[model samples]
Target: MSETPEKSAKASKSSQAAQPAATDKANSAAKPAKPAPKPKPEDKPFAAFINDDLLPALKQSLTERHQAPISLELVEGDRPVVGGNCWMVQGVLPSDRRFWLCFESDSITSGKTIALAETGSDPSLLESFLIDEKRINLALLQSRLLQRLNGQKWFGGN
Candidate 1:
């Protein structure tokens, strides 16, 4: 039996509306979507090592030894390692009252500064030490400092 034109038009409109709802439901079921979260900024890892741990340790060590007022200054420049910059520590030893300890980037090993002595009274002592690559070995610096502190040796085996 054929439906009347008016009834047929109403049925077609209802079907069209149902189709849209069905499509919407299908789309929602097809994929479970998650809301994307915003990315956080990368935090500097060496902040604690430089500011909290290393600086305080060095200062205390110097003070206990009765060395001159040890002042650690961060040297600003482009270094190969991230957050790797030279540290200049000025203090006096028991033997040599006026001295400077240079913690150059090249002289750092195993997360420790290889303290090097600034021998001359040149105005640019820090600059001179950095420029001379051969003298900045961390092991050598450690040995030299030990010797100096013990009054065993005058020069570091560079």
Candidate 2:
């Protein structure tokens, strides 16, 4: 069947309009999708222990016992763990004396640390206590270390 010129023109015009809509859809699809936002991380056991428990007790004990400024820092990991978190502790007393402690945290309330080691300020103490590794309570460890550092500085005894 032969179509009239006007009818053929009208068909071409509609087809051209449809092409633009299709092109628009394709263009939109070609654009990159927006990236999803990162979720806020939940606290790990070790981090909670450091923040909620250790820092407070250390600060209070330092205040009451020493009457000197003491700096306690987690110089290492706070990664999530099943049993507990493990980290290295760096402590600085008012005399600017520095000590490093390594521990495997069992919980906020309990953990194990090397009370003395073969490498530190007191070489004699370290060598003597090297094989005497024991899991002392954190508070006891903290107090003992602070006292020991003071003793080394002044009284010069372990």
Candidate 3:
């Protein structure tokens, strides 16, 4: 039996729609979607940024410059200076010098402070960073840290 013109047109339309759906399924089976990329250090939460990117970069930088391993620790607690829970990156050199990079809060937007103490002494050098805290990045953190250490003649020259 021959189909009428209306039935033929309807069958054609349905076949055409089914063809695209089959093509889409085949294409999807052949190609998988890529996963999303990880966020950059500056884009991550403050603690994650510090632990993942900032500390590693700082340790590498300091170790390369000082010609020895540099130790770094992140301590979170109720700091007397901030009067609340704060984040501090404490670093130690082979020469027994210690430095603390303190954040006023667990946020990149918070202000920052620094203190450095020589061997067998209390923190003798304390100061607030002058840069905008919100603009911090790994490079900036490393630069500021080296600059402060250099200023104290820790690397032995001006």
Candidate 4:
């Protein structure tokens, strides 16, 4: 015997509900995946400043003036300040010398306008440099360093 009217209506309702579920699964499977996001272009160049350009120039400057080698260790802050990476450097100047700290900033202006790469401590090395009648000028040294690295790649010198 043919199906009853009530049975046919029930079958029709069930098939209609099943259509949407099948359509949803097929739609999701057909879609392409989203691409991974790209990193900022500044990341590489800023890192170069820390490793290649700034650190070497700092070492050379210290060696020339102090007559011994210098080394820099990363002193990452709790959070980086805007406009650059966290390059707060703490190291030994002239090997086995006193601990020194350098706060990186473009705000510090010197002749020829190169990025500042120098260190300080709580009246330690800074105190010794002030001997000889408050002379042995730090600004002159800073200017000299900025001048030296003025044309090197990184620090936007190139």
lDDT of each: 0.45, 0.52, 0.79, 0.44
Model 1 spans with C-alpha error above 4 angstroms: 1-44, 68-70, 78-120, 123-158
Better of 1 and 4 by lDDT: 1
Better of 2 and 4 by TM-score: 2
Q: How well does each candidate superpose onto the true structure, as a TM-score?
A: 0.32, 0.40, 0.68, 0.31
lDDT score for candidate 2 against the true structure: 0.52
Per-residue accuracy of model 1 over 33-123 as CA lDDT, tens digit each: 7778643221223333445444455456556555534355444343322334545444444444334444444224323322334344322
Evaluated at residue 62, the lDDT of candidate 1 is 56
Report clash pairs, candidate 1.
Answer: none
lDDT (10s digit) by residue, model 3, range 1-158: 99999999999999999999999999989877788897667898887889888888877877777735367878986443334667888888877888888888887657888888888887754588745656777788879888888888988778
Residue 39 shift from truth in candidate 4, angstroms = 19
lDDT of candidate 1 vs native?
Answer: 0.45
TM-score of predicted structure 4? 0.31
Identify the candidate with maximal lDDT.
3
The C-alpha stretches of model 3 lying farther than 4 A from their native spots are 1-38, 67-70, 78-84, 132-134
Better of 1 and 3 by lDDT: 3
Root-mean-square deviation of Cα positions for candidate 4 versus the true structure, in angstroms? 13.9
Query: How large is the C-alpha RMSD of every model relative to the true structure?
Result: 11.8, 13.1, 5.0, 13.9
Over the stretch 1-158, how does candidate 2's per-residue lDDT look in tens digits?
A: 89999999999999999999999999988999778875322223666656565666666766665534467776555422222345655555555555555455434333434323222343122111112435434465557655655555432343
Ranking by lDDT: 3, 2, 1, 4
